[model samples]
Target chain A: MSSITSAKANVLVVGSGGVGTMAAFALEKGGKASVTAVLRSNFAAVQQSGFDIKSLDHGDIQAWRPSAIRNSVPNTATDATAQPYDFIVVTTKNIADIAPSVAEIIAPAVSPGHTAIALVQNGLNIERPLIAAFPSNPIISGVSFIGATEEKPGTIRHDDHDVLLVGAFANPNIAPQASAAAAKIFSDMYGSCPGIDVIYEPDVRFTRWRKLLYNASFNSVATILRMDTSRMRISEHVIDDLIRPVMLEIRATAAAAGVELPMELVDRMITVDTFEAFFKPSMCQDIEKGNYIEFENIVGEPLREAERLGVHTPALKVIYGLLKGLQWQRMEAKGLVKIPLVSEPGMKYGSKPRVVT
Target chain B: MSSITSAKANVLVVGSGGVGTMAAFALEKGGKASVTAVLRSNFAAVQQSGFDIKSLDHGDIQAWRPSAIRNSVPNTATDATAQPYDFIVVTTKNIADIAPSVAEIIAPAVSPGHTAIALVQNGLNIERPLIAAFPSNPIISGVSFIGATEEKPGTIRHDDHDVLLVGAFANPNIAPQASAAAAKIFSDMYGSCPGIDVIYEPDVRFTRWRKLLYNASFNSVATILRMDTSRMRISEHVIDDLIRPVMLEIRATAAAAGVELPMELVDRMITVDTFEAFFKPSMCQDIEKGNYIEFENIVGEPLREAERLGVHTPALKVIYGLLKGLQWQRMEAKGLVKIPLVSEPGMKYGSKPRVVT
Candidate 1:
C-alpha cells in the first residue's frame, strides 16, 4: 500500500451520505492527502454551503470546500479531477442494505498493492463480500462510534464523539499499521471536534458482534415501539422488563458467535435509563421520514447468524417477527405491490414464525 | 335529567376540538337528542355556515346544521340560545395534560342531576376531579374506541369503524346505565352513521385500562418509532422482545386493580393492527403539532400504577423515560433563546445504554 502512503495520495470517499460525508470531511481536514468526496445527488450544495459542525464544546454551522463530487463525470484516469485513487473509503448508508451495490462500485477502484479500502458501518460479515471481490488490496472492516446526520446534502451535523474501531479483514499483521495510519489522519481532521476517540480493535468481527448487543437492544425495542433511542434508554419498563431479556438473548448469541464481551459492558447497556429523554435513532428517523428501515438486517440477519452458530434467541425471534410484519403491512397496503405481511410472530426464526397462542 | 331525556334532550357538545366536534355531529345524527354544537373560538364561522363531516368509507365530505352557540348566551335553565343538557361530552384533547386551571374550564357547566360529562379521549383515568366536583351528576367515564381525527378545528374526519366503549366511574349501577343510555343514543344516531358500534361497557375504568393496553403497546411504540401500527405489530423482536413483555406488565397491574382480561385481548390488539399500517398515532400527531402530550397521564400514570401494584415494566419504563427526555429537550430547545447546537450520541441509548453502565 505504498501508493497510498509513499507517493502523493488521492483518496476518493464514495457515497457521501451521512456516515460517508463524516468520514470524507474528516479525511479532508486531516491534510495528510487530497480527498475527493463523491456523492449520489445534489450533496455538493450542502457541502459548499455552511452547515453546523456540532461538538461538545463548540458547534457552529461552518462551511468547508472539500473537493466534492456528486455522481458526475470522472475527469480522466490521468487528469487530476478524474485520476484513479491511492485509497478509497466506501461509506454508504445501507449500501449493503440492498445487496452488493457498494462492493460492485468500489471493486473497480481497488488498485491491488496501491490502495486499501475501509467499511465504516454496522453489522458483522461486511468484509467477506468486499474481500471476496478484491482479494488483493488490504480491506479494513471498521466500526464508527460517532453518530452523524446531514441537514442538507453535504452539511454533516455531528452529534456524538468521533471514535473508530478498525481491523484487517484477512491479514492481522497490517491491522496495527492500518489503525495507526487511519487514526493519524482522523485525529488531525477531527482534533477540534469533541470526543474523537479511536481504538485499534484487532478482533474487529468480535468487536462488531459486541456492538450488536447495543443495536439489538435499542433497535428491536425502538423499532417495534417506534421509539427514539433516548425513550428506550430512560424507560424502566424498557430497561428491566424489556431490554434485559432481549439483551440476555443477544449476549447468548454473541457467546455463540464465539465473541466474549465483559459483564461491565452488558451492565452498561442495562443501566442506560436516560436515553429516551433525548436523541432519535436512525431507525426511528427512517420511520418518521417514511423511509425503509433495516429491520431484516438489524434483527433478522443476526438471529439467522445466531441460529447458524446454534444460539438461543427467543426474544430476538419475537422482535424480528413483529418488525418484519410491520414492514410487510406497509408493502401490502400499496395493493400488495411490495412485500408479504405477517410471516410469523416472534419466538424463534428461520423455521417460520410459529404463533404462540 | 329525566325531563330532558323524555322531551328529546338538548345537548351542548362544547369545546369542538377533535373528539368534541365528532361527538357533537354523532349526537345530532343519533336523532335521540338535539345538539347545539359549539366551538371555543371558531363558533362564529360555523354558525354562519355549517360543520363538515368527512368519512373515509364514502369518500364524502357531508355537511350538517346545528343550532350554533356562537356569541350565544350560556344559560342551561333558559332554552332560547342555549338549553339544558342531558349529556355534555367534554372532548378536549389532552386536557389532563394541561394545568388544572386550564383544563378545569367546564367545572361550572357539569352540575349534578342536570348534565352527564363523558370524557371521550385516550388515557385510563378521567372522572376523579369531575366526580369530586359533581358527585350526583353520574360523572360517566366513557373511553371512545373509535378511530377518528378532527381534520379541522371544527371538522371531524371520521376514519375507522366508529366504535366506542361507554361506561361510568367503576360504580356497578351508575356505570352500565350511562353506557346503555349512550349506546342506545349512539346506535340510533344518523342510522349508526357509517357504523357507530358503541359497546355498553359495565366498568369504563376497566375498559380504560384495557384500551390503555392497546395504547401503551401500540401508541407508545408507534409514536416513539414513528411507524404505523402494522409495522410495529409485524416485527417478531418488537412483538416478543418489546411489546409482549410490556403487555404482560400492563396486564399484571390491571390484575392488581382486580381486573381479569380475556386471554385473547393481546391477540385482538394485534388483529386490529391491520387497519393502521399507515396510521399516524394521536401522540405523534400532537408532537408534530407542537403540543405537549398526555405523557404524565397516558404513559406516566400507567407506569406509576404498575409500580404501585408491584408490577415490573421494563420496556414501558425505557420508552417512558425516552419520551419524557425527548419532550423536555424539545421544550428546552424551543424556550431557550440560544439553543445548544450539539446533541448526545444516538448510541447513548444503545441496546445496553451507557447510563446503565
Candidate 2:
C-alpha cells in the first residue's frame, strides 16, 4: 500500500442508486477517504460519463466521478490487489425475498475485524443480518433523510433534505469502545462534506422507528392508491380515515416495542413541508416503475415486530398484505414467480415454484 | 290498467344493468308477470336494439326488450295514469355515498303498502333503507348467484349460475303474513323461468353473510390488487395471506353478529370454478372503469358491523381503509372531492367545495 493510502481511510459503497451515488459523492468530498462505488445497470453509462447531479443543497455538479467505479464488489480472495475496506458503506434497498441478499453482496470486501460495515438504508431490523454475518465487525446503522432520485441512468436530481443519522450497533460479541470508535470515525469523515449533516447517534433504533411512521403510512398509501404526496393529502377524511389511523397504529407498534414516540410527530410528519406536491416517495416510485417494492423492510418487518410485541396493528397488517400482493405482481412480471392459473404436473410452488396453484 | 295487467302481476325493475335486465327477463319469462324496466345510461341503446344476451342457462337471445321500457321511474304525483306496482325489483349497486340514494330513486314508484319493494342486489342490511322509507310495505330481499356482465351498453354475457334466494325482511311495522305472502309471490313468478331456481328463504341475513365471505375477500382483494380471480388464487400464500384472512374476519364478524357462516364455504368461494381465468369480479370491473365501488355496502358495512359487535378484524379494517383511499381517487377524479394540494382562502372542503386543503 502507498503512504497516501495508509493515511486516508478506504470507503466502498455497494449500491449505486441515487442514495448510494450521493453518499459516495459526500464521502469523496471529505477528501480524507478514498471512495469506490459499485454500480450495476448504470455502470457502463457512468464509466463513459459520470453522474450529472442537480441538487438543492449542493449546487449543480456535472460529470462528477468517485475515486474509483466498479461493476461489482471487489473480492479479496478473488482479486490479488483488492484493498481491505475500512468502511463498507452499503446504500442498497433493504428489500426481502431477493436472490443474493445485501449480506451476500457486500461480504467480499469485509476485512473481518478491521472493516466496519455501515448500512445506509431504510426500514427496521435491517442491521441484524450483517451482525449475524460479521459478529466481530462493527455495524454502523444509518438513516438518511435525503430527497434524491436518479431520474435516468447516471442522471441524479436531489432537491431536498440531506441529513443522516449514523450509529454503531452495540453487539454483545464485540467491544462497545471499538464499535463507538468505528462509528465516530466514519461519521466524522461523512459529516465533513458540505451541504450534508451526519449525526453520530449512539442509538438509532428509535430514529428508524420515528421515520417509519411516515414511510409505513404515507409511502404505502401513495403506492396502493397510485397518488403522489399532493393527491394523497387531498382530503381530510383521507387523513382521518386512512392515513392518520395508520400512523397511529405505527406509533402504537413502536410504543409497544418500548419506543415512546410522541403524538405531535404524526402531525409534523403529515405536514412535513420538505416534499413538493408532485413528489412521490421512493417506494411509490419503485412501484410505478414496476420494480419490487421494499415491502418486507418498510412494512412487513414492522408488522412482524408488532406481532412479536403483541400489538394490535390492523392498519399496518392490511397494508402489508396488500403490498405483498402488489410485490407479487412485479415478481410475476419478471418470471420470478409461477402463477398457477392452470395446474402443471410436478411443478414446484411458493417462492421457487413455477406453478402458483 | 289493461285487463292483462289486472290479471298478471305488474313488476317494475329499476336500474337496468345486467342484474336488473336479467331480473326483468326472468320475470317476463315466467308468463305470470308483466315487467317494465327503467333504463338509464343505456336507455336509448336498449330502446332501439334491446338486450342481446348470450346465456349459459337460457339459449342466446337478441333484441329482447321487456313488455315496457321508460327513461325514469314513474312519479305518481306527476303522472296521472301511473300504476301501483306489485313488486319494484331494485337491482342497482348498493353504494352508500351518492347524490340520489336507491330509496330516493324508487320513492315515486312506491304505492306505499300496495307495492312490495324487492332489492335484487348484493350486500348486507340493504333492506333497511327500503324498510325505513315504506314502513308498512313488504320488503323482499333477493340474492342472486349469477355470472353476468353488460359487455357494452345493452349486450350481456350471462355464462353461469342462475339461482336466486328470495326472502322477506320481516319489518316489525309490517305484518308477518304480508311480508311472507309478498316474498312467495315474487319468488314464484321469478322461479317459474325454465333456467332459474328461486328459493323463498324466510330469513336472508344469514345467506347474505355467507355471500359476503366471497365478496368481502375475493372481490376486495381482486380490486385492490387489480387481479382477476385466477391470478389472485395463483399462490397459496396469497390465499393464506390475503383472501382467507379476510374471509375469516368476515366470518368472525358474522358470527359475532349472531350469524354463523360455514368454514367450508371459504374454500368453495376461493376455488369457485364458475369464473374463467380472465373473469374479473363486478367490483374489480367497477374500479377498472373508474366507477364508485360498492365499498360502503360490500366491505364498509361489514366492517362497521364488526366494530359494533366488538370483533377484532385487522384484515377487514385494513382492506376497508385501502378501499376508502381508492374510492377517494374515483371521487376526486369525478370532481366530487376537492383536493387541497395547496391551501385556498376560505374554501369549503369535504364532499362539496373545490378546495381540498
Candidate 3:
C-alpha cells in the first residue's frame, strides 16, 4: 500500500459507459484527481477522438478525454508499473457476465488500505460482495439520479437530473475512521466537479433504498410494456395498479430488512415529477439494445432478501417473473442460452384421437 | 309457450365465428334441427357462399350453409313471424362489449318456458346474466374442448380435439326437469353429429371449474407474454412459477365458492397432452388481433368472486392487473377511451430546481 499521501490522487474508472464516462469527466474536472478509464469495445475510438457528452447540465462537451484509456483490466504484474489508485470507481450495470465480477476486475488496481471502491451502479445490496471480497478496502456505495444515455459507442446524452448520493458502506467489522476518511475524500473530489451535485450521505443504505423506489417500479415496467416513463404516467392503471403497488411492496420489503424507508419516499416516487417525460430507464434501454437485463442485481437480489425476511412482495415477484421471462428471451436471442422447444404448445399433442365421447 | 313437440326443432346460433360455426354445422348435420346463424361483418359472404370450415377432424367443409343467415339481431316484432327458437345458442367470445350483452341480444328469440338458451362461450359464471334475463327459459351451459380459430371473417380452422360437454344451469328456482330435458335434447343432437363427440354433464359448475384449470393458467399468461403455448411450455420457470400457482389459486377460489376443483385437474392442465404444442389460447389470439381481451369474463369475474368469497388469489390478482394494463393500452390504441397524459414523469417535476444538495 502507498504510504505517501499525495495532494493529487489517482482514480481508475472501470466500465466507462454513460455513468462511468460522466464520473470520469467529473473526476478530471475536479482537478484534484487524475483519472484513467478502462474501455471495453470503443477503446480505440475514444482514445483517438476522446469522449463526447451532449449533456443538459453541462451542455455539449466535444471530444473530452481522460488522462489515459486502457482496453482491458490490468493484471497485478501490469499494475506494478503505475501508482495504486486512491479510488476505483465501478459504473457498470450489475448484470452477470462471462468475465470476472466487478470486485475481481478492480482487485489489481485497488490499494489495500488507502483506496476506496465506489459502486455507482443502480440496485440494492450491491456492496455486500465487494465488502466480502475486500474486507480492508473501504467500500463506498452511491445512488445516482442522472438521466443519461450512451447514444453511441463514444457519445453520451445526459438528458435530465445529475445528482449523486455517496456514502461509506456501513460495515460493523471495518473501522469507522477508515470508512469515513475514504468516503470523505471521494465525496469531496466529486463535489467540486462542475455540472453535478454530490451529497455525502452517512448511511448509504438509505440512498440505495430511496433510488430503488424509482428503479424497481419503473425499470421493468417500462421494459415489459415497451413504454417510456411518460406513457407509463399517462396510464392510470399502470400507475395506480402496477407501479404504486410495486413501490409499496418494495417499501414493506425494505422495512422488513430493517431499512425503514419512509412511506413518503413511496409517495414521492409515484407523485414526484423528477424524470424527463420520454426518458427510458437504464433497464428499458438495455432491452431496446437487446442487452441482458441486470435482473439479479436490481430485482432478484432484493426479492431474495424479501423472501429471506418473510416479507410478502407479490407485485415484486410478478414483475420479477416477467422480467426474467424477457431475460430468458434475450439470452435465447443472443444465443447465450439454447432456445428450448418446450414452450411450443402446438407440437405438444401429436395428432391424438379427434373424437372423444 | 308451445306445448306441442315438433318433429324438427328451430335453432338460432348467435355470433357464428369459430365455435359457433362448428356448433351450427353439428346441429345442421343432425337433420332434426333447422339452424339459423346471425353473422356479423361476414353476413354477405356467408349468405352467398355458405360458411367454410377447414377442420383437422372433419377435413375441409368447403361451403356448409345453415338453414338461414341474418346479419343483425331480430327484434321481437320480427320474431313474431316465425316460431320461437327451441335452442338459442350464443357462441361469441364472452368478453363484455360496449354494445348490448349476449343475453340482451338473444332476448327477442327466447320462447320462455319452451326455448332454452345454450351458452357455448369460454368462461365461468356466463349463465348468470342469461338466467336473470330469461327467467322462465332453461339455461344450458356448454364447455367446449375444441381447438379452433376463425382464420378469416367467414372461415374457421379446427385444429385439434373437438369434445363438447353440455349441462343444465342448476338454478335453485328453476324446475330441474326443464333444464335437464333442454340439456339432454341438445346433447343428443350434437352427439349424433359427424366428426365431434358430445358428452352430457350433470353438474355444469364442475365442468366450468375444470375448464378454468387450463384457461385461467395458460390464457392470460400467453396473452401477456405474447407467446404461443409451445413457447410457454418450454420455460420451466414460467410453468412452475407462474402457470401452476395461478391454477392452484383458481382451484382454491372455486373451492371457496362451493365448487371443489381437483388438484389432479391442475396437474393435468399443465402436463396433459391434450393441447397442440403451438396453439395460442383464445385470449392470446385476441391480444394479437388487438381485439379487447376477455379479462372480465375469464380473469376478473373469477378474481372478484374469489374476493367476495374471502379466498386469496394473489397470483390471479397479479395476472388480472397485468391483463388490465394491456387492456388499457388496447383501449388507448382504439381511441375507445380518452388517452390521458398523466404518466409523464418529466412533466411531473415541472421545471423543479435541477440540483438538490
Candidate 4:
C-alpha cells in the first residue's frame, strides 16, 4: 500500500455544467485540497450565488465557497491561482472547438506530483488529446453516472445518484493510485457514495469503440432521427427499417476491430428497464441550441477509423451524411448568424471558458 | 373524346381543410356549374367576411360570390340551390372510419353516374376501403397540387399553383366522362392551372407507389426527424445515412409492386434546382402546428407492402419503430395523458375494406 503522504493538492473545475459543478463540490468537500471553479458567464452566475447540491442522500448541500472565473485559459498556473492545478476537471461538450484559445486560465496552483486530471464527458475519445497535451502528469479518464444540472453559477442540482469510473488512458499501473485518490476525494463530498470504479482494461481502445458503437447507433440515430431510444424500440416503421441494420453495422465494425463487445451492449439498449424518453438526447440538445457539434470526434473520426480498419460502415456513413446535410442546411437557413454546425468554428462568446471535469 | 354531358354539375366540397376549399374554388372558377363548400368552422368566419381567394397567378382574387356553408360533414347539401352533389369531394383523414358515417349522412342524394365521389388525401391503401363502400360510380383517385387554405370558411388563399392528377386505382380505361368534366370545371380557376392531369399510366400501381415513396421519405422522415425537405436534401447526415437507404428501399418496394420509377425521383430530391432551399414541406408544417401525425398512411403502408412483395426494407422498418417510440415518448413526457406506445396494434385506420378494381 502506498503511504498516505501529507500533501496539499490544487484542483481546478472547468465548464460549469452539471458535471463541472459536481466535480467542484466533490473536490471542496474532500477537504484534502484547495479547489477553484472557473466558469463562463452563463455558469459564473450560478457560482456567484453559491454552489448548491441537492443530493438524494444529503437533501441539499448549499453555499459552497469556490472561485468562479469567466472563460479564459490562463497562460501560467500562478496567474489564474496561487499555484497550478493538481487536477483539472473538464465536463463540457466539444471543448476543443469552443475554447481552442481558452485553455490557459485555471485555478492557479500546482504541485505536479500531487496533480491529476479527470475528464467527465460522454463520447468515446475524450482523453488522448488531453493526455497528449500533458504528458508527465496523471491525466485520468472518468465516466460518470450521476445526472446533475447547475441551476445557476455555484448553484447545482443533483437529481440522481451517479458513480464515477476513472482510468489512465495509456498506463495500467497508475489505475490503483488514481482510483484511491479519486475515491477518497469523491467519498468525502457526501458519505455513502456508491463508490468509484477504476479499470485498467487490457485495451482502452476497445472500451472507447464500444462506447462509440452505442453512441453511433443510439445517439446519432436518435439525434438525426429526432427520437428517443424507446421510440426506436416501439415503432415498427423505425425498428425494422431504420435502427437494426445500423446496430448490425456497428456490431460488425466492433468485431472487425477485434473488440468482443458484450452482446448486452446492444441488447440492453432495447430491453433497458428505464429510459428518459422525452429527455432531449445530448446531440438533440446541441441541435436545438444551435451549438457547434463535435461531428468529427463523435461521428467522423470513428467512421474514418472504421474505413482505415477495412470495415464497411455503410449505415453509419448514411447517417453521418444526413446529419452533416441537416447541420449545413440549418446553418444556411439561419442566414447571417455565425453558427457552428460541424465544428465550433470561430465562436465569439463574451466570457472565458469554464473549467470543468 | 368524351362529350361534356354533365352540365352544371352540383359539387359539394366536404371538410374544411386546404383540399376542401381548393376543390370548391376550382369548381367555381371554372364556372362550369354550381359549387358549394362546406367547412366546419374556419370557413364560417371566412364566409361571413366574404370569401377571399388569392390565386397564384390571378394574385388576390378577393370577395368572390360563391356558395359557402358553415358546419361539419354529414350535413345536408340541401340549402334550396344546393341539392345533393353531382360530385362529393370527401377530404378527411381516417377516411375509412369517417367515410361510412359520412356516406350515411349524404345518402339523401346518392345517384349513380352523376354523383361520382372523389378523394383527395395522402397515402396508399386508403382509397380501396372508400371505393369498396361507394362502388356504384367511379371513385376517381385525385392528387392535387392546388395548395389552398381556408383561413375561415369565407376565405381561400391560393398559396401555390397545382393541378389535380386523377386516375382509377387499377383501371386502364373506364371512359372517364366525370374526369373530363372535372377538368373543364378546373380550367376556369384563375390562370396557370395545369388543368386536371388524368393519367391512366400503364402502371397505375407504380404511380401510387411512387407518390407513397415521396411521402414516406419526405413527410415521415422530415417530420419525425424534425427536418424540412430542403435541409434533408443537403444534410450529409441525411444524404448518406437517412435518405439514400430509405430511398433505395422505397424504390425496391415500388419496383416489387411493378412501379417503374425514374432514377430521377431521387436525383430530383437531391438537386431540386432553384427549388432547393425555398420549399415548405408538410412535415415541418405539421410540427409547427402541434398536430398528431398520419405516420401510418405516409410511411407505414409502403413498408408493409414492401414486405408483402418479398423485399427487404431494413431502413423503413427501423424508422417505423423509432417513430412509434418517439410518439409514445413524446406523449409520456408532455402531459399526464398517455396515448400508448403501440399504435392501436396494426393501424386500424383504413378499415372500410377494399373495392375490387
Q: Candidate 2 clashing pairs? A: A338-A354, A340-A356, A348-A353, B340-B356, B340-B357
Among the numbered candidates, top DockQ falls to 2
DockQ of 1: 0.09
Evaluate fnat for each of the predicted models and list the values in order. 0.14, 0.30, 0.17, 0.28
Go through the candidates in order and give the C-alpha RMSD of each one to the true structure: 9.0, 4.5, 3.8, 9.7
**Range of the 10 consecutive residues with the lowest summed lDDT in candidate 2 chain B:** B348-357
On a 0 to 100 scale, what is the lDDT of residue B284 in model 1?
Answer: 68
TM-score rank, highest first? 2, 3, 4, 1
TM-score of 4: 0.73
* Candidate 2 similarity to native, TM-score: 0.92
* Residues B37-56 of candidate 2: C-alpha lDDT, one tens digit per residue: 99988899999999999888
**Candidate 4 docking quality: incorrect, acceptable, medium or high:** incorrect
Ranking of predictions according to lDDT: 2, 3, 1, 4
Candidate order by DockQ, decreasing, is: 2, 3, 4, 1
**i-RMSD of model 1 (Å, 1 decimal):** 10.3
Predicted complex 1: CAPRI docking category: incorrect
Q: How well is candidate 4 docked (DockQ)?
A: 0.17
Q: Higher TM-score: candidate 1 or 2?
A: 2
- Every model's DockQ, to 2 decimals? 0.09, 0.33, 0.28, 0.17
